[model samples]
Target: MTKLIHVAAAAIFNPEGQVLLALRSKQQHQGGLWEFPGGKVEANESVLEALSRELDEELDIQIDHAATRPLIQVPYHYPDKSVLLDVYKVSGFSGVPHGAEGQPLEWVDIANLEQYDFPAANTPIVNALLLPQCIAITGNANGTAEYVKKSVAAISGGAQWLMLRAHQLSSSERTALARQIRATIDAADGVVLSLNGSVAEANDCGVNALHLSSDKLMVLNTRTEFRGRWLSASCHTIEQLEKAVSLGLDFVTLSPVKTTATHPEQPAMGWQAFSELVNAYPLPVYALGGMTAEDVDQSCQSGGQGICAIREYW
Candidate 1:
């Protein structure tokens, strides 16, 4: 049996939501086809450790604190070799992305990853990236923490990832609340603590990443200072999605997978429609727009990393 090459890669996105695709040398097997920058995993290193090392050696870039965003774990197979590709979003790097392996490079939008011919093994990865997601902050009502009593209750029930979309709180008040949630979430690796609209608050609160509205997403493009954080955004259309991509957002909420009870007045893009829209998307997408944890498995089956739901949380 051929030994599987442990591999890692960086889907480095530019300010336009375009990903950096390295073109292979004419001598390579997948010559002329484009790919994310990375290389084979080495011995005894964690996948992330290997990713960091490989990116530096392969692209001559440093994986700084903010750009180190996890995208997905992919499994691919070739005639002679099998590979497990641990991919990440290089959101913040010190230098221009280059191909240290002597391959040419191009930065393509995430939606275009499939357009360029990559190895067959990378197909699933391409899909994982295109799916949209929505992370709901259960227990909070209409962007205000009534008491945080409901928020506490919801987490106990099942909501693993919670965002404090508390719009009404004063900065000091919200920061305190986020810090409290962070303390609670620290124990649950599966649970993430995210904050709405404030990178400074998130970093100070010690949460996971930032969730930006399309408005906010647009404002932050080309700004690499992360406050040492994970970043996400909200997208309604392909255009906004590109902005998120360019900014190197860690994740995002692309909503209304189903006709949402909360937003019934708003039109919905059914599952088929959502899948079609997301076809060939290049980043990890969580099926948002009215989905639940129960729907997560189905979302992955359809074309997403999983489903992110506000209603089903806890």
Candidate 2:
């Protein structure tokens, strides 16, 4: 068996939402490609310590450790080696970032990251970067007009990602509502709309993504044909999370982080349990159920991509 090598990487972002990418030297592993600034974790240092040390060594900046948020962990295998990448988002830092190691560096816009070549392990990191920290879901609106109004408000309030989820609507009604919401989202310029239904429904509605219910998640053994569309699942247990990962879904929302009105009887996972589950998995997981935008920082610290709220967010 090949031993696992641990690497700590940082996605250092600027105020413009552009993340810093380092052009690996031609002689280095995965060289001549743009990658996040980081290095191998030393035996004696924690992942956080290694991350802070590496950023200072490679970029000549001191990261505010308190402000660092755990982003994603990616495990990839090359022909000769296996590596576990521990990545974090560095938001606060002292000193300007420069290529202190004599390697080329550039701040690339999050949306255009795919234009450059990156290591296979970094693909998920790039996807996570493109996703918003808070995903607003249109919850239990009384009518199509009400749903559209709330969705527009959410988008206008700076929510770049949204899930239109009026499960009570009939098939025809749902389709019509989806079209109206999609038009509104497009008018907002580049907002991503995810429909809470099956692949066929999402495709028919012409949405950007699909959100699978937990029951849908359990029945699927393989990824669906939603080419060019993001796929997300609602996960409750580790088993559900593992299933979603096996199906290669883009992200999952681990729910009931706190007791929600919809499921008051369901037990809450709490922050500690939620952290444990996410840390054990590599894919980005969002804290769902009774979450608000104000809980984003806490969610990040708990190893979540962010909060996926239905009630509070809307």
Candidate 3:
């Protein structure tokens, strides 16, 4: 096995909601690329400890340790090296940030981050940052009317990322609901709606984001081309997560973080297991099953993008 080089990185943000980035020195590996500021984790130091030290050394900033939370862990392999990037969100910090090490620093709007070049390992980090902290998944609904009404409520209640999971509805019903929701999203800026169904269904709906069930995820040997901007999956185990990553998915939802009323018999994985599983891959993960809007911070603390809930979402 290749030895993993552990690196601690920070998605440092100012009060303006812009993230701080640094330009990698041309003399360094993956040079001329923009990267989140961080450095290697020493054997004696914890990831947080390393992150604080690295930020101080690199940018001369003091991060508020309490406000720091695990963001994402990325495992990337090059021809000659392997690295495990343990990243954190630094929400509270004290400093007028500068290039303490001579590298140029820039605070960029989250929307404009894609305009800059980044190393392959940093791709997932960008995606994680771009995703909304609260995701609303539609649960049981009586008909297209209820689904549309509930979906609109979710969007109004601040769920920009909505997943329509109406398995009980007919294909045509689902399409109707999707079209209505899509129109609503179109009128509102930055709202996204994804379908948790088959490609055929997605095509019929003509939506831009598609989410696959775990069963569908395991059946695919490779990522089939889809006419969508975002592709995500439902994952329960490390194996499922591996497949999702292999498919180059945009993100995934790992379930049973807590026992739900619907699946009360199924043992909950709890937060520790969820965190452990999320660390295995680079894909942005959302804590699903028994999640509520209030659980977003806890989810982020456990290395998740945010909470994805059905009932308490809207």
Candidate 4:
């Protein structure tokens, strides 16, 4: 078995919403790339302790314990070493951060972070940071026109990300609905639209992102058609979440955080259990099934990205 190195990392942000990044020196492993600043966790240290200590030592900053939250934990393996990166979001901190240890530091805009080269392990961090907090999924509509209208309304009601799941519609109807949604999304700034269907349908609709149902998520071997685009899945268990992580998916929606009319047969995983399952594979997860706009804060506190809903979000 490969020895696992436990590291605590921080996605420290400034008041302007820009994140702090540090450049690795030429002598370091994965050198010449930018990375979130952090250090290895000592045997006796807690993750928060390590994070606070490292930030204070390396950047001369003090983290506000109340404002710190769990971000994502990444388990990455190199040819010779394996590491588990326990990441946190440091939104509240006091200090003008600088390169206290002679490392060059940069404050980068979140959207522009992609211009810089990052280690493979840092890829998921970028993706998570780029994602929106809430996603509105279109429920079953009477027709294609109604679907488009409802989706546009959801966007109008402060939902920047939308998942169009009109599976009841035929291919041509679905394409038309998607095109209308795309047109409205294109008009707005930073709006993202994804299709909840097959790759062929997504391609035909001219959208770049595809969301997979649980069954489809289990059967995929590779993201052959979705290499450059965002691919997400709906997962319910650790196994399904593990499959998503292994397949290099962008994000996932874990369902039944509470009892819902849609899937009453499936028992609700209360906030505590949901947190436990999420901690096992801490991808950017949106709480689905019985989720509403009101549950966003609780979801975030329970280690979720946000809420994915059909009714309440719309």
Candidate 5:
């Protein structure tokens, strides 16, 4: 029988939409497969404190300004023992990453993560890496195809993922246009597509993924009946992020990373404050709202998956 243990882990992403994975030394348990850099949480140490300490020891790098946000806290069993892992998104840090612990490490781009096998508990975490940082089309009132085309151009111009949010349109119209955009994305062989709603239908379609609305994400339950497809959500609160984890979401958006013209009245959490909130849990979190690729370095500092922008990247 396996005994349960508790530990903390970190999913560290870089500015180029890649994440850091470490290969344990031959002396360590689970010696071959790669893992996010972290270790068992010590008594009396806060999760973030433990994360910072572990990274410094294991990687031999100072966490000069790292945002170690709690992501998903889950229990996983290895044949001999089980562990309650405290996962965090490590947004930023200084110095080149070296395995001071004598382990090998790789900085993997999102698309390349599947190449390495990870522990079963970290499987969901791996999928989270594949989720896109959506750049939504700002104007739905205009012609759908034209707007979508522009979005595609933006995607070619470095925007990798997009969400077609025709919120006010009737379901049928939205579906029609979304389908067209889906085809366009497919033809391009580059950009990924996600629809705002109708996931059940989106599943039937060939689009790369589905983006759940805040309302829909709230009432959802059970892991989405999906495999090999990315699922994402818009989360403005901690509660929503929890629900997303429960629903087996691939990744989530922590929005308004900065105050933006998009939502003038809504207060932005800024990078530092958001990092603290994120430090509370471990999940693949994107720093959404008024962010750009330039903010990527900063966002990763806050434990973010990457930056999801409106005016910034788009």
Candidate 6:
């Protein structure tokens, strides 16, 4: 087995939401590529300790550990080495960051990160950083009219990302609802709309993204044929999450993090277990089930991309 080298990295963010990235030295491994500022973890140090040390050594800045939120841990295999990157979002820090090791540093807007060349393993990290912290899901509204009204309200109330979910509706009915919601969101100028349906339905409805059910996710061997559309999936167990990652879905929603009225009998995976489950998986994960907008920080702390909710978010 290839031994995994553990690395601690920080996605240091300025107040403007731009992430700090460093240009790798040509002499080093993965040379000339842009990467998050970090280094290999020493044998005896904790991930957090290593992150703090690496920032201080590489950037000459003091990291505020309290403000550090767990992001994603990606395991990537190279021809000569394998690395398990433990990444964190550093929202609070002291001192201006400058490259102390002679590597160049730049603050790039999250949306424009794709314009820069990054290692293949850094792709999911970029996605997680760019995605919204709250994903509002449309609940069981009484009718199409009610659903449209709620969708508009959700967007107006600051939901930049939304998932139109009406599993009980027929294919045509779901497609129509998705189209209606997409129209409303587009008019709002910046909100992203993801429809909860099949690839064919999403294409027919002209939606911007597709959210697959866990069942559908498990059966897929590759990504769907929706070109230019973002793909996401619902996940429960680590097996489902692995499947979603293998399919290269943009993100995933891990459900029932907390017990809900809809499924009182289904066991709730408390925050601790949720954190453990998503600890090192690369794909961004949204904590779903009985979540509210207020849980966003806690979700991030627990290694989730954000919180996804229906009633509470709407």
The lDDT ranking, best first, is 3, 6, 4, 2, 5, 1
Candidate 3 C-alpha lDDT tens digits along 122-213: 99999998898888898877766777788888888888889988888787877788888788678878988999887778877888899999
Model 4 C-alpha lDDT per residue in residues 1-314, reported as the tens digit of each score? 88779989999988899999999998988988999999999999999999999999999999999989987777788897888888888899998899998999999999898899998888878887899889999888777567778877898899979998877888787878888879877987788998888767777878878999889889888877763378999998788999998888989999888999977898998999888877667468889989888898898888788889888856
Off by over 4 Å in 6: none
lDDT of the candidates, in the order given: 0.67, 0.86, 0.89, 0.86, 0.71, 0.87
- Runs with alpha carbons beyond 4 Å of true place in candidate 5: 1-112, 128-138, 225-228
Q: Please say which candidate is ahead in lDDT: 2 or 3.
A: 3
CA RMSD, predictions in order: 14.0, 2.3, 1.8, 1.9, 6.0, 1.9
- How well is each residue in 8-113 modelled by candidate 5, as lDDT tens digits? 7888877786889998666667767889889988889987788788888888665644454544555566676777777776777877889886778888887788
Q: lDDT by residue for model 6 over 191-275, one digit each (tens)?
A: 8999888888888988878899998787766785765458999999888988887788899988799998889999998899888
Better of 2 and 5 by TM-score: 2
Tens digit of per-residue lDDT, candidate 1, span 1-314: 66667778877877778778787776776666667778877778886788778778878877775656666665545676677777776677787777787767787877666678886556545655553343557445533344355566656776656777767778788888777666655776456677786666666766656676678777774535456445777777888877765565555566677788768987877777666555434455677766766786566545456666666754
In model 4, the runs with Cα more than 4 Å from the true position are 1-3
Per-model tally of clashing residue pairs: 15, 0, 0, 0, 16, 0
Which 10-residue window in model 4 sums to the lowest lDDT? Answer: 275-284
Top candidate on lDDT is: 3
TM-score-better candidate, 1 vs 4: 4
User: What lDDT is reached at residue 13 by model 3?
Assistant: 90
Off by over 4 Å in 1: 1-136, 141-152
lDDT of 4 at 130: 92
